[model samples]
Target: MTATTTGGLPVALLLPGQGSQHPRMATGLYSGEAAEPEFAAAMDEVFTAMGAAGKPLRADWFAERPTVPVDHVTRSQPLIFAVDYALARLVMSRGVRPAALLGHSVGEMAAAVLAGVFTLPDATALVLDRVRRLADAPPGGMLAVAAAPGELEPYLGDDVVVGAVNAPRQTVLAGPEAPLEKTGQALRDALFTCRRVPSLTGFHSPMLEPACRGAEELFASVPVRAPRITIHSAYTAGPLTHGDVANPAYWARHPVAPVLFWPALDALLSTGDHILIETGPGDGLSRLARRHPRVRAGTSKVLPLRATEHGP
Candidate 1:
């Protein structure tokens, strides 16, 4: 939805995660001057790196043709990041600025890039590398559950673990695929709605422990600088400083770490009334933000950068 008129300048920018990316998402925005070059460059680099020969997957594929397996975490992560980065750059070029930035799941990397914590080149490399690492990890997966955190605790006993805390009522579970199926069945039997996520690997769960160690070593060698703006970390539900970047272990542990998105969003709203701009190919985060009490109370507004005129 279009933001209701508020009294102050925009105070926050919300970026989406892996589920949002689609091929040619920037076609309309690319037609504009501010976004054209960035979009083209990101596409070229990503395509070249992925080595996909045919046209990239787009939303049209879902409606016009049969679905394909383009939602793999490796490709999805960078693809979503590229779209949001382009959108953020375009907004900045147009003189719109935010007092703070936040992202969910892989969206955090894009937020880091936008906040100036990492250069595009470094961030892109890290994202691609993360995909490679995650792909090579153990075979596990994640599933969405429509129960509140407390309600889901009984299910997290032995096999399943909480993956993402998207909101007060939504949580994601990660574990071995077999366990995921069992978990989903159990939740369904309990009358709780659940759906399996696309990625076949458990992310933000204990399954990533080994990869987290390797990531920590990788981050030690990479140089992490400061961000131009404040960036709230979903891992900690607090602001991330340059010093935090040096500890790659923290980021590596992140995937298996529980996502405190609702709390992070709460912290973001505490700053002031903000025009929350969701920069990406999807509106998932914007939709979540709208459900938050602060946003619905007219204290904040959520906007997604979809090409369509309809509000997120």
Candidate 2:
């Protein structure tokens, strides 16, 4: 962590979730004016860690086309984590130190590693283990629903659950594909905009209990340290305690837990005069941060590092 200058703008770094990933997402980061040696070094460290774990990230990420589809959850999850983690390091290398950090879904794994909760190797292993278990999980799907969770609960029964609460009006539903398709149609008929997310696993629902259970041993084997920086958690939807980060049980359950990003964004904005930077490939976090009442009420500025036409 870098020291904050007196009277400098307080910045919050945002790490994105799954949907932010793309083919060769890392290529542009290495050539930009904002690029730094540390960024490339961090990429090396990440790839080395992945290779040591028996999965070479560079071969897929830098290939003409990925040998394995980049969007496959098994591959995508770790690749996104690596890109987001490297980008965050790049930003910090340029002296844009964040006073706080926040990560959505798989992004939290990178957040934990950034906060010093786990070494890069340990975090990589944990992600791979979780994805491995989920690959065997039953077929399921997710739906992006443009409605409040409370308004949509009637549609959620045994087979469906709220996967994420992204905004006051935007929520995601997760469950078996059959039921999710039916629910998406009903929501569309009710004049709510609904779209099926391109995912085969119903993450954040009870359907992932097996994956969660399978991760218990891996989570326990990993060593943890208290965070060196403040990191708001989507899993807890608030500031993370040392205990929260240190507990293997909390991590094991994270996959099946709803991503409470809306509340987490509120928590970040409540801190005075924040500049929220989306440190990954997309502007999703920036878009969500701008929607918060605090940003609208004039306490924060939302910025996107990767989306700008010019390098930082």
- State each candidate's clash count: 5, 0
Model 1 bad stretches (over 4 Å): 1-6, 22-38, 41-68, 307-312
Using lDDT, give the best candidate's number.
Answer: 2
lDDT of 2 by residue, 257-285 (tens): 89999888877776666778787877877
Give the number of the best model, judged by TM-score: 2
The alpha-carbon lDDT assigned to residue 23 of candidate 1 equals: 49
Q: Candidate 1 — worst ten consecutive residues by lDDT sum?
A: 53-62
> How many clashing residue pairs, candidate 2?
0
Candidate 1 per-residue C-alpha lDDT over 161-239 given as tens digits, one digit per residue, 9 for 90 to 100? 9888888888888887787888789889989988877676788787777766667666667777777888888888888
Q: Residue 62: error of model 2 in Å? A: 2.6
